[model samples]
Target: MVRVLAFLFLVTAALALDPLPPERIQALAAYSNAHGGHALLIRQNGKTLHESYSNGHTQNEPHRIYSGTKAFWCLTAFAAEKDGLFKLDDHVADTITEWQSDQRRSKITIRQLLDFTSGLEPLFGLHQNDFKDRAAAALKAPLVGTTGKSFIYGPASLQVYHELLKRKLREKEQTPIRYLERKVLGPLDLGPQRYLPDPKGTPLLAAGFMQTALQWSELGSWLLKHEEIVSAFKPGNVNRAFGFGIWNNHAAESKSAREVDVEDTLDKKWHAQSWGNACLCRSAPADLIACLGSYGQRLYIVPSQKLVIVRLAKDSKPNDAQMLRLLFANTR
Candidate 1:
């Protein structure tokens, strides 16, 4: 009788010790702020953590999510796939039938475009051009490397992929943006669609996605729960997750713009790779916390603990993770 009681007590204690609650999420937010940006953490199935800082305001304001737009693009593309609009391996060069004559683009594939392995030379850095000029340049751009040799990591690849996506949808009389509204954003109750276009009036898929941090946070939460979406990022998975545009936080190849210079911070696992617009994302402190606590804002996902941490800012420097650690410490 005594042994059984002791065993039951041990199990009960273990369950009670699990570290998941609103308070812990809040601590992550405070810690994020300490890292350098104003922060917030939220829990919706799991915890979401978000941090933002600028101009004496953090919440109740929307900020641009620079590269985070990539996250949005990933979702939209998958939605297109789910609807059988196109296969993941469909060739972008062939899909955009109008570009068939372009020899430089012939070898490119959809997967290459999503993974930043497209060989297309850089076109965005040139002075922004009118739609006609941008289209012409995009069509004729030379290859810097063969398709799929390495990761060049730029917006033009996504932009081209966006064009391909638009073409596939347009054939069905569906606009890419509208499809997103009906599938990804609408169900989540997200709105105030804010996106920018190039001089040629093309939705800038590589960047240009603009929304409040709250909306982005909501989108992130959707991503956390959707296995179909998350499955796209896992290795050896049918999604061929690494090759897809989706953010794969687990792979060794998965790396972010911010990396630790110090050896001490290397093991924290606090450092993870995520892709989002670095300059355009803006959100309230609470919203940031909520988004991050749920989805981990790209790098960290403590599902068992139901925690996430996110950092957003303009001119974000490399030491940002340290600032996040400080925010957590101060919360205590």
Candidate 2:
């Protein structure tokens, strides 16, 4: 009996220690504070390891996740595919119809749109507060390049996808947001969560999702359990480091992996020569996938480590590689 009790005591003691050491946590806190981080939450092996909120922020408040919103739609697309809505390889022109006349535009595939290789012009104006009929605006935007060539990261491509998805659901008389809520968020219990909509009542798939750190972590957990859906995180050919709506670290050692600063990409320079071609963290596990947004909102899932981390900030600079290095310093 004594021996059994001793074993249990040791296990409890081990569990009591923070996964990250005190000094490391201090360093992270200082780094976060210096960079406008409001909340940071980490979970490992299905247990809460650490949670911190600052600058008058609390765990209950929902903060805008910005482009982190894209991952949800990406996962929803997987669900939509399973439900026979459309295939990833389906050409956008087949459904958009308007694109059929333009040879380059007709070549755009559903996969290419989410992968940011659709060659559509990256229009930031679709995200403006007063912009009405964002989907119409996106559909009307001309293709600036050839499909399957370059990674053009912006709201226009996703908004165009919104229109495509809208057309797909037209027969069923269901909206994209309603389909997403029913197919994805409802199963995950992530709604009653807020999604900002445009004047045409289309959910802004490119940005404007608000959820608390814990709520976002739930999404990471859900992704970890759904392997088929997680396959969307695989590195794409055009940009070796990006997948559907997330950044991948799987190709950190690949010769084709191009390094671009995450902070610089958010400055609305969607047409820049260098974008959408970098690992989130070189030192993190190769299976690490991240949903990053403007202003440092991050949802990181490390399946190999059985870990999920959510960080919410106002407009902090990205130091993902450094932060992951600290997080994994002692872990094997």
Candidate 3:
């Protein structure tokens, strides 16, 4: 009886230790504040361990997640697939028709678009404040590289995906945003999500999504429970560290792994294409997955530990490696 009780106690203690101690949480909170953090939330095994807001930010105030918005569209795509809208392997040319004659464009698949391997020109205008008919513009953009050849991180590829999805759902009168709400956000019970639209009224699929820290945490939770969406985390062949709108740290375990210096890589000219090869945190679990945005916004999920952490900020400054080290300290 004593031995059995000890084993049970060990399991319970392991489960309880996940979100780190209060002192460490306080340290992370301090780190966040020093680096322009607006909000932070950490959950383990479905329980909130820490939640804090600063700089006049409230718990429920909406904040732009920037590139983190990409993950939501990725999820919506999986949902659309489940609903029989189309398969990931389908050629984008099948719906767009405009690309049918262009051999390279005709070979672009829906998966490539979601994974940033579409070879579409990474347009700056799509992200600028002067939004126009982004879908139409994306359709008009020429392929800058061979299809499935390289990973180009930009709004243009996602915008092209928006155009494809729009054409696919045109007969149903369901806009991409509406379809996302119905299939992905609705089931998660997330939103009043703010999706900014272009002048021609197509939702900016790549960026301009706003949700509170709690709301985003809920998304992380939902992702943990959804296998179809989780499957999208598999690393793409073009960028071994990046999947469909998310970064997979597990790529470090692959035989083809290469170093990824985030600062140096991000500094390359937007058009100078390259692929990422390293894990976000070499010390963290290989199963770690992250939804990162331009301005330090982050949603980290570690399935191995049943952990979900959210950090929102005004700019990119926080170090994910350092944060993970603090969170996963050895309690022994």
Against the hidden reference, what TM-scores do the models get? Answer: 0.68, 0.88, 0.89
Cα RMSD for predicted model 2: 5.0
Q: Write one digit per residue (lDDT tens) for candidate 1, span 133-213.
A: 454566556677666664455556777776777778876798777877788778778763655655656665555445545
As a whole number from 0 to 100, the lDDT of residue 40 in candidate 1 is 43
Pairs with steric clashes in candidate 2: none
- Expressed as tens digits, the lDDT of each residue in 1-332 for candidate 3 is 99999999967966665456788888888888888989999898788889999987889888888878898888777877888989999999998898899878889999898887887777877886567678878887877776787777778888888888888889999888888888878887875466677677777777888888888888788877775667666666877778788887785556665545454576686456466557676556778788888778999987766778899998555577677666654531
Error of 1 at 239 (Å): 16
lDDT per model, in order?
A: 0.51, 0.79, 0.79
* Consecutive 10-residue window with the lowest summed lDDT within model 2: 268-277
Error of 2 at 66 (Å): 0.5
